[model samples]
Target: MEAVHEGEIVDVHALIMSFPASNTGFVVPLPSENQECFLSGLKLLFKQAGGIPLSIRIDNLTPAVKKVRGSEGEAQLTDEFMAFKNHYGFKVQVCNPRSGHEKGNVERKVGYVRYNFFSVPPVIKDFDDLTEQLYQKFLIDRKRMHYRKEAIIEDLWACEQKQLLKLPDNDYSVFKQTTIKFNKYNEFKLDQHLIHVPKAKNYSQLYCITFWNEFKVITNEGEVLLSDARPYMRKRRLIPWKDILKDWVYKPRVVGHSRYREYLPARVREYLLTPSLSLRKQRINEIITLLVQYDMKGINEQFYELISKNDEVVSNPYDVEWSQYDALQPIGGENHEGNH
Candidate 1:
């Protein structure tokens, strides 16, 4: 599928699964026509349908067919796709080479979707939101009478749903795993897109799990350090400013000289370079560490609130009771660390 997204042309694969018996269709947008996308799309479709079909008829696409056998023989399914089929307990039926007519049910469904959903050239801000709207539209359309079945499509789907295989006890993780080394700038490139990893050491290896909608980087022990929504724009750099601050805290002086300093809120920049505050290395480190624990916006609010008090004497930024800051609270509750 081709569409304009965020002022750029995006080329993606459309996975359309059609149930001829009920005239029901499930559509999933994939990043590519690769093995991972093929499996992920199917997994998402099954999850939405709540069950697997007894058998799935697929086109002889490159992702699914490693080698096409004779018309009478079973086409060799790619190992990854084969494993997915086995996990879902579904029979695989492949169409003959150049024989799209065999999967006409889904082909027409794709056309219908393209006409109804993509015809207007959607202004997509979020890829997930677009897919969700498409799915809801599909459901609403199913309330109509079936073209030839002489019954409501949704009603017919109810009957077809009864014959589907039950969902497996465990859900599948749909991602393509890769290892990448960070550059001196703590940046890594994926599919020509640059991603900045804050506080990452140069030459350190990071594991990435690429999904259809997003990608994540994890430590060697599998703790997720960074995650970003996959960008359609080529060669785009995704930088998390919060993560960037993790590195800036080590060099307090550089924070003032960096080009991003101007981007910081005025209160945060002023507090960092407050003339009245001691710039001793230990004091700088303490302020940096504390600021990291609290968002600049929240800290700025506190700064203004305190500065407004005529009765209170505020000398140094560190003089504030940062531990009492609301934003510093841990996710579950407050931290029980020693007094600051």
Candidate 2:
């Protein structure tokens, strides 16, 4: 994590998967898997049942739609995706770009895939072997009755398909995928949002956002992966760093901006680096949450109060304050010694 300061590249990506009562996943693939094929498979599965959902809920995925700007009252839906939705007739809704609770269904799906399949997928060099491995996972492992739900995932999927929305007549090509470039300050523009990435990836192209629509930046060579949304820009808003500012508080000489520090109250700035690591970290995260909850000013004011009581701010008000005893004796020593 310290590499974030040394200007290392940070990548994050979001994964969306599906599971049934079998407690096993119907899909699992590497982050770099072919998105077109994956979406086609999903369309096929939904077709088998009936159609797509009346409304599809997803995290903010660029290929599907640009994030909806709540303040602006709408988002810029990509041209290709607009057509896809028009064809499918499934109204797509996004979770709060930052709120996981809004999309618990998909979150659980991701968990199941990671634990039950991908963690131990049978690997092979050939595509045929890979397909066979996937088939075993879907048919053999995923078909078994679940322990807790006591029902087969296959059965649940069948029912879900029966009620899903239908695919459209026209073919839809997936987004070729896009790259995120961080500015000199190690910040990248995610639509109207501004996100700070590690400086390492500056001017290099190794990051991309996935179709499933969550902020998980991933590197091309698989060296580092992290979770962060593309930031939005709201004028005069000082967003604090989210949960990660703990790393910054203890460093003696710091330079940079964070979601947590951006919105710090004018008064609180003086004390931001004073708190203990854990306490300061928690405070930083809380301020970020508060910034999301209220405006930056409101959150900063709260911060001003949060630390007001324990104002043990060790500022060197006088870097060269002389003790009274030293001040009185120091003048005589040089002169007396020289005379002797």
In terms of lDDT, which candidate is strongest? 1
Residue 215, candidate 1: Cα error in Å is: 2.6
lDDT of residue 25 for candidate 1: 90
Residue pairs with backbone overlap in model 1:
none
Candidate 2 local distance difference test against the native: 0.47
| Residues 1-340 of candidate 1: C-alpha lDDT, one tens digit per residue | 5543322345656788899999999888766666667788888798778799999988788877888868567689887777778888999898888898988988899899888887654434345655686689889989999999789999999999999999999887767889877777888897677789888783257788887667888987887889887654342222245565656656656766764554444444544564442353343454345555554445444655544342234543344444554366432221321110
User: Which lDDT value does model 1 have at 141?
Assistant: 87
Candidate 1, superposed: residue stretches over 4 Å from native = 1-12, 71-73, 181-189, 194-206, 223-226, 231-340
The lowest-lDDT stretch of 10 consecutive residues in candidate 1 is: 331-340
How well does candidate 1 match the true structure in TM-score terms?
0.59
**Residue by residue across 1-340, what tens digits does model 2's lDDT show?**
0001111111212234443323434442222323443454455444433456677666666555555658867666666666666777778666666788886756776675556654422223223334345556556654666557757767766665665555667666544356776776776665456666665554356575544233556667755455642231111222224434445645423413443332233333434444355455444554444545565444334543544433444343212232542364342232222100
Q: Model 2 — which ten-residue stretch has the worst lDDT? A: 1-10
